[model samples]
Target: MSVSLRVLDDGAWVSVNDSRQVSVSELWRLDAPEFCSCTVPDFVVENFQSVGVDGRTITANVYGQCIQCGETGVPGWIPVGRLKNGEYVDLDRENVVLPAHDGHEN
Candidate 1:
């Protein structure tokens, strides 16, 4: 029994055809006791030149290995956002189908 997801749809993920893309959720890892001010990982937008503000969300790209297989298959993505209390939030979603970067056709 496989379940599907969608954006502006229902559940955690949105289904587009046979594949599904879920809005990744992340919990910010605060090094300091204060939540209002925290540092984010670099990979979470290292490729981008600027950091844009989107409502309460701060989008970024991150890198990590698969915990299960220990394979460097895909780099994890981090979705950062600020809470009403000024605390930062970050969540890591694994195995995201990222855009192809190689010269080969996608």
Candidate 2:
């Protein structure tokens, strides 16, 4: 049983395969953190906000549509924010980093 995250943007689906780990509780928390109030997942999103002072999980709405194809369910934890140049900023910053591609194929 493999599930994936699908973000709906610009009438198209974007794959957020950041490690491909799925949890039902985590998704529920992200959709409505105030109502659910679950611990924030160990990932970085652009529009993560803290509604409460306790400061655990983020209480922000993911402002995109589901992009995962074939009904794999809603994509989990998409940080909502203003992105520059219509390009996505990578949220994964763990371990030693690799050089970002400058649109030049090697």
- Best candidate (score: TM-score): 1
Whole-model Cα lDDT per candidate? 0.28, 0.25
Tell me the TM-score of model 2. Answer: 0.21
Q: Any runs in candidate 2 off by more than 4 Å, and if so which?
A: 1-32, 35-77, 80-82, 93-106
Backbone clash pairs for candidate 2 read: 6-67, 6-68, 7-67, 8-65
Residue-by-residue lDDT tens digits, candidate 1, 10-102: 233322323433232322232221112223211122222112223444433332333333332223223333333443443243323222121
lDDT of 2 by residue, 1-106 (tens): 1222343332233333333121122222133222222232222222221111111211122222212211222223333222234333332324322121112110
Predicted structure 2: lDDT: 0.25
RMSD from true fold, candidate 2: 15.7
RMSD (Å) per prediction? 15.8, 15.7
